[model samples]
Target: MAPKLDIETYPGNIINNEFVPTPNTRHSINPATGSPLFKVPVTRAEDLDAAVEAARKAFKSWSTTPFSERAKLLLEYTDAIEANRDELENLLTKEQGKPLSLSHTEMDFALSWLRAFATMKIEDEVLQEDEEKIIYSTHPPIGVCAGIVPWNWPILLGVGKLGPALITGNTFIMKPSPFTPYCDLKLGELAKGIFPPGVVQVLSGDDNLGPWITEHPGIDKVAFTGSIATGKLVAASCAKTLKRCVLELGGNDAAIVCGDVDIDKCLPKITTLSFLNSGQICMLTKRIYIHESIYDEFRNKMVEFTKNNIKTGAGTEEGVVVGPVQNKMQFDKVKDIYAQIEKQNWKTALAGQAEESRNGYFITPAIIDNPPEDSQVVAEEPFGPIVPLLKWTDEDDVIDRANALRTGLGASVWSKDLKRAERMARRLEAGSVWVNSHFDVDPRVPFGGHKESGIGMEWGIEGLKHYTNSRSLWVWKKIFE
Candidate 1:
């Protein structure tokens, strides 16, 4: 059963494991209905200071807490989330404008991630032993951490930061994007009794909140996920405090489809991947390079599939595979690209008109037919349902074209020939390369971006290291003998 949307019952920020309300508040609008979903505390500089100080005060003991105890708490928190999964997922769909099905998927992914971290342990490493001098290394939490989560996948991304930060013994303060703050704020509320005071906190506000947290000297690290433009600003702010940052930014990911592949088998997966979350995912395929031999066939099949299978509507509506675009800003951006396509008279294989009856930010998916390589739609990260399918005859040329962009977050090569796909995957300049698949990420593996896409990594053991600093311990033989 879906949970009720109750804005009046909204709880404020979670600071020191207590609900902290503010004099000022802001409303989060439901993208699907263009109506206010709920009101959240409008956190300001002073509020951020209080949250940071609380986290700082709590860090002394939290960081030193036994790993086993911390793990038990995290596991308990995971259980709590699971028990309320339906309620959270419903709220996520209402606030974030994703299909209810996808919202459930996001919840499942987050639960799995939390469980993974609950079972993980970071033990000291013995670098050298059985010698005159013994050397070992210890990974310790890096004080207070600020997790700036994006709206696209709020719950899952929030967990991406929370799991590592908490498991590694760091007191964390999360700042959810103003566009979607419900689930994250609720998460903080749910964790109140499970985690110690100020151990896990959440603050919600407008644009000002991010700068307050990032620029604050009390924060030891900033883990951000957003656009490349904002990511640069985050890195700059963190630099002022000499704080560590893990950024997962934008991607203009490409998928190279080979001629020998079975078009029937691959078309379903390709279309789904390309338009997953209405093509808002950072790693979703934005550029398609198909061998000229199969370009026409692939394009036709993909167009037909999209026209018949993909439907956009309110997230609560049944049989709706694609939900409305998250907000107005992104909706305008997508419309701007459509205007460019119309001006250029670019050929479109399939164009689903925006649904006007819904009175929301709804734009049908579009497939541009072989636009120029240098066109804005192809070069820039549209981060919308619109995507370009280009023709490529040569492998070397396609590889070069795929790598020409400033971003290298993810890419995929599709072909029945495993050896050939492997060879091509090796040369694709991306943090993750897949053969005949795209955007399938696991919590156990390291995930991040390359070049301007991001800095540092998240998830896996490497991600845990990002939340900590290594300390070297050495023992020297005494010469008293």
Candidate 2:
């Protein structure tokens, strides 16, 4: 069971370094308990205007501040988050419906990312230099960026936008999803004293908030992480202003298991990768393709593991390995896919029922064995605990099937044979490919999807450059002389 929370007292929008009340407020429900968790201000268009103006004002000084000085402030922010790590983690678990342990890991990643960004410096580049002319390029900050974060990993994704935007000298205003807004809003409140008046701000609201932020003339860039449908809307809105945008959208990641691999050693890992965070992560393995020779054995092992080890309940429950779906919307989405599975009469290797007797939105993890290629469980990203296991006879055939989807965010190949794994990994179409592992990301490596998965990159030097624009400088010597 989870501790009862007082959701009424959570902070509202942060503008000009202070928590301000808005014209209206909305309540966010706890996915694990199916109850109201907190009430956040529903930021209207006017509130967005105010937040944008505040960011614009702060950018004047923040953009000009030395990179070293900005780094110091970010480090300070990292320290503050670390100091309050436990409290933040608990809050995240309560609202986000991730296990407390996973919430701690999210905080850990957020801290490491902030620290990494703090130490990085993008120096001016000299494109050409000669006795007669010197040409150099400067990466200047794009002012007043709006970071739209999703609910799955709100704090980490929010910081993913913030680290790059702030380290590169742009002011940021974050719009957290209404599903999970408590921790992010609190983070903004904590950052008030660390950053300048408007360097970092957070606003929470209903669906309207995202459009207002993306379309606002005052915003120079929009960094968004969400579904493909919503990402398209955000892009269209930014297109009107010709504002820069970085979108990390949806992914139906695939994991291929080779016949040559050891099933005993690999089955445990594969199950963990598939169902981690209740399958909410964008990069998690949604589709599993196994070689025909080992498909039956692999399927049996996976079913046994999931049946024995995978348990779903409230996030705060001590022995629960998986928590409830993040919210009712996602829960219903998963249920719809289950309905499709039932309609198709797909072979179910393992399935469990939700604890409707309890108040939380709990659904048992499900594993479907070899659904049709065009089935919704196989073709679409379920983004839930439901996954399909397909058998493939040929490597080339599986590669083609894996890449056939509209989304190409991430994929993995598992085999004990190093050379074989690498060769297959190269052929799969994705931004990130792993051998024998999945969802292992580092702050230093660049992460983004190919095709419809996302546009632009995040978390590396390439990510930092996205928050800035390039300006060329040229000096001609003695042309007249």
Candidate 3:
């Protein structure tokens, strides 16, 4: 169960680096009980303008701060988070339920984000020189930026974007999803108390507000992580200003299980990744392509492992598996998607069931067997406790089939022979691939998608570049020609 929070005191956008509850607001409720989760202010255009102005004003000085100074402050922020890890974990569980273990790991992902991004070097490098002339390349902040984060991995996505953007000296306006607002607010609380007002403005608002932020002339850049539809709209809005963008969107990730792999060994890993955070993650594997030579045998082992091993409870617990769906809309999506899958003439697979006692929009982890490639379950991201499996006899045929989708975010290949797995991973046509692993990401590695998955990248050195604009300085030798 989520820890008790005073829902009445829910806050709003952190404008000008201060938390204020806007008169206009959106209410959040626990999916399990339909009880009040927390109320966050739904900001208006004026509110967005305030956030932008604050970020812009703050950016004037923030951008001037030396890289080492920013690095020092980022380290301080990291320490602040470490001081209240447990409290933040509670916030995560209350709003977005996953296993307690995974929640803790998410915090770890945040810590590493600060540590990794802060260590980046931004020094002027002289490319060519003459007696009194030099051509220099220097990276500087792009002023204020807007980061629209998704609900699935709130802290991870928010921090991943913020860490790099801020470490590079740009002030930020983070629009976190309404489903889990408290944690982001809590992050804002920490920042406002420590950093200069407007250095980091965290806001909460409805859907349309994102477009306003992107289109706002004050914002120099935008880094968004969400669905393809919304991402497209955001891209269009940013294009009006030609502001740089780093979009990381949807992923109907694929996992290829070869005949050579041991189903018993790979089953647990696949299930863990497929259902990580109840499959709400963008890069999570939603489609499983298995070799036909051992489909049935593999299914039996995988199904048994999934049925017996997965757990559903609050993330505060020590060994809980998947927790409640983030909110009712997600619960309905999971339900509707499963109903469609079951109604289809495709072969029936083992289905997940939400225990009657479980409340707050919880659903069983679904496993579809030998489903048709055309099935929506196959093509769409269920983004829930659901897994779809398809059998492929011809390797090239299946690879082509998986590559046919609009989303090519993350993918995996499980095989005893590492060479075969690597070959298939290369052929999979996605951003990042793992051998015998699913959705295992490190702060140091570049993570993004292929095709509609997104453009540009996040959470690596490449991510730092998102907050920057490169300039080349050329000086005349010997006082001009």
TM-score of every model?
0.97, 0.97, 0.94
lDDT tens readout by residue for model 3, 1-481: 1223332355667777666777877767655455776568888888888888888888889998888888988888888887778878766777777666777889998998788888986668899997888999888899988888888889989988888888888998888887777788778777776678898888888877787888999889999988898889889999999999999998898888899887767787877777778778877778888898988887787777767777766655566677778877777888888778647855556777644335567777878887778888888888888888899888888889889998988888889999877888889888888888877787677888889999988776666776789899898877755
**Which residue pairs show collisions in model 3?**
25-42, 31-360, 31-361, 32-359, 32-360
lDDT of the candidates, in the order given: 0.89, 0.88, 0.80
Model 3: runs farther than 4 Å from truth?
1-12, 129-133, 314-318, 354-359
Instruction: Supply candidate 1's per-residue lDDT for 214.
Output: 84
- The best candidate by lDDT is 1
Candidate 1 local lDDT, residue 189: 80
**Tens digit per residue, CA lDDT, model 2, 1-481:** 1222233466668998988898788888888777876668988788888888899999999999999999998988888888778888988999999999899889999999999999878888999998999998989999999899999999999998999899999999988898988988878877886899999999989988888888899999999999999999999999999999999999999999999998989888889878889889899999999999999999999999998888777889886778888888888888888777667898899875644436777778889999889998888998888899999998899999999999999999999899999999999889999999998887778889899988999888888989999899898987999
Error of model 3, residue 150, in angstroms: 0.9
Model 3: worst 10 consecutive residues (lDDT sum): 1-10
Error (Å) of candidate 3 at residue 50 is 1.8
User: Best TM-score goes to which candidate?
Assistant: 1
